[model samples]
Target: MKGLYLALAALLVAVNCEAKEPPTQVVYRFDDHRSLELKGWDCDGELWYTDTQKGIHSQVWSQFYRIFTKKFIHPSERYMAISSWGGGFTVSKDYGKTWSGAHYSPGENEPNGDNRPPYDDILSFTVVGDQGFLQTKHRLYMSSKPFDDPRILPGGPGIHYELEDGVKGDIQSGSAGWAWGLIYMTRQGLKGTIQELQTSWKDLPDKTPEVKGYTGWDHMRCDMDLGK
Candidate 1:
């Protein structure tokens, strides 16, 4: 009886430890080095932030696990990656309710992305996404999705994406009063500003206009590792 109890105790301990262990997928998923974060959904921000699946992780995930984030985040279909530049296009088909993590890569043949992405400066681009309106230097040029070439938007030195109603996500929501993708310059350097855009079922014209000071390309740079 004592021997049996010991064996059962060891098994229970092993099982508990296994349950507590972080899966291999999680190990890969949490390796986030980007400044911008994709959030709001229930996956605990893991889809955008980590390579790890919630549980059922693996060294080489199965097909189901392979596109798990892509599937769960179903971005392009609903959300639009409203950016002033290339990387870090957060689209939400659900109308600011939730964000779709689906993303677009500049691919192999782009102005700054031909074999070398326009600067390896992929943001989720908190590096460039600043607050000033139509600041060109901060504006980046990498073809957006569905476009084979990179496109340029008027903004600051760093890149910023603007998610609005009826872009690609077909979401009918608003950013409220907070404008999406407005980065505030700080001691830490340029970062992506996150604000809720006002969503309206009907179109609201720009009633009033204002100017805000934001960083510009005067501070633009490329990732040395992924030399542009």
Candidate 2:
């Protein structure tokens, strides 16, 4: 009886420790000497980046929503950007040396559209070339110069998409909002500040906007290696 009790205590201790462990994921890897990582789970987490070549390893952002937020990198151009749930963008022009963050107050009502319900959730967020976009249930927000701001482009109707299994579930409904591809299918049509997208829309063979850059973060993997 004594031995059994001891074994049960040990198991409980191990289980508790494991449960307390924070989840981590490698969100991006630019090269052998540079990378980004996300630590913690859900909305409570820190964003960290390491540039061995630049002798930098540190947290860039904190208390971010990991599930809905993401970072984008243009390695060759030394550009790094993040679309945040707090209603803005965080960008680093010189790799990780500098950062500019913009956001609307979470406590405040989000930007709403005509006759549309309040925008409270993020459906999708993406950055292509120099343009950035954030989609909610009823509103589509854009930023042409995401490096400076995430509200450059005009607001309009948000884009709707079917999940892999054709269900759009999320926090309010158990369906999560993952990264989405850029589609020009909106009420705004082919009108935007991003010249590439606007130009591409002009010659689109069909009325449907061509989906582009769906696997944008495929190359950005986050791996945690707390070295000894």
Candidate 3:
């Protein structure tokens, strides 16, 4: 009888230990030089972009603009999209070591003084479900297979093209499958919006209404905690 009790207690302790272990987390770290550098861990907990020479090609590192990752169509398949400072975009089926460029051309609509490829200088890009979305100053584009072709998403005029009063905008995606549209301070106030991409964007209600009295705002690098 004592032996049976001891075995039951050991089993309970083993279950408790397993329950106390934390789940794996995906982390993204960004650094900026002339362009931007991004490194992260995938769901497997393997560190990506660690190799200096073989991690990312030289051209990609120098002109890197932004990098986005998502579990698009398949929950098991992770996809990464990277854009350039000048104009083009690329995709990595694996975590970002290798890439296949997108065949997009802005042509006559290309921004002035941006000498890189026409498809490179993306203002914001993200993947929601099976669809990938890209926003330039002028248009919003969507694609399923991003490397093949991307078409313009309707309702471009409804979207805010640029930040008001010289403010900057950063678009980030949440693991819950929503995009957070964060705008820096403007003449009016600091604004934030949430977009599901099913409909147009909407303003997120101000949480701290009591806090006020800022004249102007400049860009600042701050860490964002994306909670599961």
Candidate 4:
């Protein structure tokens, strides 16, 4: 009986030690000059500001394990936006006090439009004022009002895709603005361009001007001010 009690005590000690292990930490920098470091442990999650002296804060959502990127229109903590690794988008207007639903489905058919599924390869999600943009593997979808009534941006599918061979590149959004934009790589070179809200696309002449010897590129990133 003495030996059995000792073994049980040792097992309990091991379990306690395992429980005390630190959570996985990941830092995400956004174009709105916000840097959030997330500490995730199972179903519990915490976020801390890396740029300021603000302390850690908890999140009610449990599925923060694999957030790809986040964006917001202003520097304030309100109206935070994030995209998940499993191709979902979410928004919090009150510093995460409450959250909008995580949108995963493309919903039903549109009036006079073909029935297409919601994008399942969301690489990035961003919001600029009342406008929102979602970048997928092969297309860019935009909503003039919040996250509703999404429609394909004109010339968007071609931005990330090569015009010559129809091959898609690694495309992603960088900043949140009325003129927010995307960066992509092609056989020609790496390029950056912007699209105004409900307007046309324009190229940035100075950004990523050259990629001399590189055949391909991936995981492109910009600074806190969006390479400004």
The candidate maximizing lDDT is 2
Candidate number of the best TM-score: 2
Report the poorest 10 consecutive residues by lDDT, candidate 4.
182-191
Model 1: per-residue Cα lDDT at residue 164: 57
Tell me the tens digit of each residue's lDDT in model 1 across 45-151: 22222222222211121112121111011122222233323323443333233453333222322334343233234322211112111112223222112211111
Model 3 spans with C-alpha error above 4 angstroms: 1-77, 105-123, 145-228
TM-score of each: 0.24, 0.43, 0.29, 0.41
**Which is the better candidate, 3 or 4, if ranked by TM-score?**
4
Which stretches in model 4 have alpha-carbon errors above 4 Å?
1-13, 21-26, 31-33, 42-60, 69-78, 95-97, 104-120, 146-228
- For each candidate, the alpha-carbon lDDT, in order, equals 0.26, 0.46, 0.33, 0.39
| Steric clash pairs (candidate 2) | 26-221, 26-222, 26-223, 27-220, 27-222, 28-220, 28-221, 169-175, 170-175
Clashing pairs in 3: 86-121, 87-119, 87-120, 87-121, 88-119, 88-120
* Backbone Cα, N, C clashes tallied per candidate: 46, 9, 6, 1
lDDT (0-100) at residue 134 of candidate 4? 54
Could you give the candidate ranking by lDDT, starting with the highest? Answer: 2, 4, 3, 1
Tell me the tens digit of each residue's lDDT in model 2 across 1-228. 999999999999889866776776767665577766777754247877788888877666776544333333333325455654443556565666766664432221333423222336555554444444555565444433322111222242233334555665212111211111222133343232132222122332222123353433533443334220
Segments of candidate 2 deviating more than 4 angstroms: 1-24, 30-34, 41-44, 69-79, 84-87, 104-124, 128-131, 135-140, 144-228
lDDT of 4 by residue, 1-228 (tens): 999999999999889866774454434544333454555554224444332333425453454444443332223255455544444445565554555544422322223342222444445444444334554454445432333112233333323434445654533343222221221212112213222222233232222122233221122222232111
Local distance difference test, candidate 1: 0.26
